[model samples]
Target: MKKSQLAVQLYTLRDYLKTAGAVDRAFARIREIGYEAVQISGVAAPLAAVKKAADDNGLVICATHAATPDLLGNRAKVADELAMLGCKHTAFSCVSDFQIIDRGAVLEFAGEMEKAAQELNQHGLTFSYHNHNMEFGKIDGEYILDLIYANAPHMLAEIDTYWVQYGGCDPAEWIEKYAGRQILFHLKDFRPLFFTATTAPVGTGNLKWQEIIPAAEKAGAQWFIVEQDSCAKNPFDSLKDSYDYLTKNFVR
Candidate 1:
């Protein structure tokens, strides 16, 4: 089995990670909390400075959630930025527009991604799309999400288990369906409120991590990123709880 490391998405700490100095302190705290890897996003520092912080603290940037405009606009340039951070795994994170409802818009996006994936592959980088519940609506007989992946074979799937559940699908089933294409898996827990689902730490909520973790491992996932968009307590403490849970239980 390929080793899967537990990584925390920096976006989970976005409120605390803005400037270069803030990023440095956050990385230091992450290391102190025993997280050895991170998935970068929303950091304002230059790529060199970000790389330096990770290197200085012995943190590995396993993947990143870069801007969608940057990825679809100039993939080669994005590839250069990723290379600078010694990162080969990346995803657009989410779609900001409702154009995914239009077939033509999806096709256009897929075409751009095909070329971008090719460019990224040439640079030894992998590209993927991270989903939210909005992607659940199906087009034709297939999901817009599945259609996008089918259109670009080189583009990988970075499945978020919680979103899959929120979208009314079994996350493990989707994980198995995209077996070989997943490069990074987002590990988040979900709990039902009155009419909606809310984010929780990895194991403290309703997610079946045992099933999800093994499924992702079977699918060749390299990093399992713990991400909780909102937390009830201090966000860092919530992250620490998740990090400790995964380390003690799943990660090898």
Candidate 2:
């Protein structure tokens, strides 16, 4: 399948979502830019309003990213809200604060995630975990991400390419290795520095998008959400440039 056929994660337009009437307008602009699907984050509008905006703008809410609190404690309510907005997947973008401490804490957090995944499965919705750099830390000679996946093999992951690279791992290799376990990815590019990295538009970074995109597709990734945490210019312009660059050059 074509990369353009994939969805855009609306968190990429977080600035717009914060503005008045911007959520509605952003969906319209997303459609205008040839995106038919979106993964919602920080959706401030009512479920009905969000659904209406998506429908009016010809966009499909394929998945949603929520806080761990929203997913673990208020899952049923959150699931209902997502269902009302036509979302099929609910992804936890970050873990609870307590889970940030050490390896043991991470394992404990993984157990909680497993339970949450089972709960979400019962609700007829798929659950996913979105990764950040910290998840790549080594624990007992294995990455924390590996431990989480092992603990809950059924739970899906939305891997962030930039974070994968930031953690000193190859995102494409993981895509191939974890095929069928990762259903989505945040396809942000990163520029490698001496000890840190900087994010840039897709092809402008050292992410090896040429290899990663195809590997993700082969791994059954249904959505590739282009995300840049910080942009030199406005977020919308950054997204537009990234979208154009990907469609015109990177995607085949």
Candidate 3:
């Protein structure tokens, strides 16, 4: 797929959307910036209102990242909302805080995800998990993410490239290893700082975009959503720079 065929992860714009009327305005700005699609993190407004904003801006809501509590407690409601908004994929944004401390908690989480995936699958929505740096930590000499993938082979992964680097692994390697299991990618770049990785606009960071993009495409990534967790300036400027860079260098 062309690089212009990109989706913006609305989480990157969270700061701008903190107030009541900001989400609608943010969606409009996203469209004006030339994004064709969006992956919603959370919209405090009603589902209908969110859908209207997307429609007004000519942006497709292709995917969403919901908290595990929302998914488990209100699977039907969540699925219905996503379906109404024209989203085909729903992902658990992060593991519970407790799960982060208790490594064993992931097995139960995986079980829950398996059940949730089964439930959402019936509604024509594929379920997935979005990873952070914790999943890359070594447990018993293997990455915890590997264990999750092993336990829930059918579950999709929204691989965050920056987190992969932060976890001290290669995003392209994971892309090649998982292949078809990764349905989407969070395409953020990382800049090395001291002992850690920091978010940078795509192409400006150390990530091998040339290698990673092609690998993700080969692995069947349907959406490459741009995300910068903490922007150096306004979120829109960061997004515009990243979008321009990717389009100029990667998009065909």
Best lDDT among the predictions, by candidate number: 1
Q: What is the C-alpha lDDT of each candidate?
A: 0.84, 0.78, 0.82
Q: For residues 1-252, could you state the per-residue lDDT of candidate 1 as single tens digits?
A: 222377889888888876778888999998888888899987777777788889998899998887877787777778877888888898878874565867887887778778878888888889888898877778877788887887778899999988998998889999999999988989889989999988898888888888888899999988888898888898899998888788778756
Q: RMSD in angstroms, all models? A: 1.6, 2.0, 1.7
lDDT of 2: 0.78
| Each prediction's TM-score versus the true structure | 0.95, 0.92, 0.93
Candidate 3 lDDT by residue in tens digits, 132-202: 88898766787888877777766898899999998889999988988888777898999888966679889
What tens-digit string does per-residue lDDT give for candidate 2 at 87-170?
778788875446856778877888888887898888788888888888787777888888888887668988889988988899
Between candidates 2 and 3, name the one with more favorable TM-score: 3
- Pitting candidate 1 against candidate 3, the one with the higher TM-score is 1
Model 3's TM-score against the true structure: 0.93
Best by TM-score: 1
Arranged by TM-score with the best first, the candidates are 1, 3, 2
Error of 3 at 74 (Å): 2.0
